[model samples]
Target: MASRRTALRPPLVSEPDLPDIVSPAAPRRSSDLRAAIIEVDGEADLAHSTLEQCVLSGSGSALDLDGATMMDVDVRDLRVAKVSARRSTLRRVRISGGRLGTLDLSDSGVHELELRDVRIDYLTLAGCKAVDVRVDSCRIAALDMPGATLSRVAFAATSSDEVDPRGMRAEHLDLRGLDALGFLDVTALRGATLTLRQVELLAPVFATAAGILISD
Candidate 1:
């Protein structure tokens, strides 16, 4: 007698592409800083430095924090050429109305960062950890955050040409009213939320990722 062959079975439940995100951070206030005209020179700890309508000029990381922290600061109209802050922390800081060349925050930790109405040429937060980061009404040329970890991040009414969030881990990502025209790695947005219009715009990308064939 001939034996019968058994057929293979498919998976009962498919695993989710995104990770399980936990609760986001609560809102917190920073200590009020006095208004002054402060300059960022060599390694320093800028605490309570409110330089509104001031120009912070530097050349290739002329100002280095070196594991320092900048807390409760408000910088408006920033004119920094290049700032390399890899081992610094920014807490409850607000920056607005400026044309920054490069603001490198790689391998750093930021909390309650708000960049509003600013135009950044190149911004990098790669391999960094941020909480409660909000970029509102800003125009960023390039925003690179590969391998970064974020929580409670929101980009409201922002425009960007290049946004690279590959290999990033984020929770509670709010991208409402974002007008992005450059390359958007949709596969990296597994745990992000989007509006209905955004879903419609990225339908083809999603279909391609799902291995679905669409015919006319």
Candidate 2:
């Protein structure tokens, strides 16, 4: 008798309830916002803030969200040049239909986060601890995860130019839906679950890492 394989667990995420009436205002630095819709026209400093049941929509040149705690927040149609979200705590957050440049979530704690239909120039999760994160229908130029710890992170219908996962630790990380051009450190993908085609494509990279040269 053969042993049965375990089923992969997808990210268990829940959508936030849409508010019927929301207060419209501009974002402030280090302020507590609840049940508000923020429209950013220019640069806004939202660092050290607490946002719950809020919607952030609009275009801006820069948005700073470092050291913030966000729960049940939705970011929709937000186009920003630079987004700094380092050292933050995010729970039940969803970002959709946005274009972001330089999204840095270093040293942060993320849970139940989902990003859909978004385009990002640079996304880094350095030194961060993340769980149940899913990226779907997104385009990312560069994804760097050095020194990061991720659990149950899955990517679906997502494409990336490069991915560097050096010194990263992951469990139940599904890479089947990710179309990545190359990986910087193949050895860092020990705990990930990849498809058969991905393994065939990465054979040469693994061979080079193991000092096994192939000649035709």
Candidate 3:
């Protein structure tokens, strides 16, 4: 059972209610735009603003944002055709309903990221780093964090199909209700610690590390 606060799903910004993403006479930066709904037909620069329940799209890209702030956006519903953002921060961002696909956060950065009630696949956090992260009620099919830092993270009731925990340090990487997690590159799990299920799943590898043979 969900709490009452989460039950009241907010309404999305309507197309007509949104403003033109880019205008010839439009303000130069996001700080210049004060309207709630914005629509653009070409590339535009968006710096700092409170964009709520609005749609930012363009033929090339409704909006070309460099440093923007978003909250509870319907990004998870955009699937693979969603907009691209850089140097932005997200909070309470949910990708639970979206079809799990490659999430490119290679060079991007964030303060806090939340993944809940979503489906994900092939998430690439190559160089992305976050101080705080929360993952709940989501299904992660394949996760690749070659050079990423996920400190003070919390994960509950999530499914990890293929996980590379090498070079990834988590004060606590909670995996209470998970089934299987793949091991790749073989170096990611160098210093990773696992619970009972994780140990059972990776027993062969552990045995090899200890020079003990349980099965011939």
Between candidates 2 and 3, which one is better according to TM-score?
2
Q: Residue 77 CA error for candidate 3 (Å)?
A: 2.8
Candidate 2 local accuracy as lDDT?
Answer: 0.91
Model 3 ranges with Cα > 4 A deviation: 1-76, 81-88, 185-193, 209-216
Runs in model 1 lying further than 4 Å from the true structure: 1-36, 40-63
Q: TM-scores for all candidates? A: 0.71, 0.95, 0.60
For each of the candidates, the C-alpha root-mean-square deviation to the true structure, in angstroms, is: 13.9, 2.8, 8.8
Assess candidate 3 and give its TM-score to the true structure: 0.60
Better of 1 and 2 by lDDT: 2
TM-score of 1: 0.71
lDDT tens string, model 2, 1-216? 111254566778788666777898678888999999988787988999999899988888999999999999999988999999999999999999989988899999999999999999999999999999999999999999999998889999999999999999987788999999999999998778889999999999999999999999
Q: Pick the lDDT winner.
A: 2
lDDT tens digits, residue span 99-145, model 3: 53555555456545666676766666666665556666777787767
lDDT of 1 by residue, 89-113 (tens): 7666677786677878898888877
Best by TM-score: 2
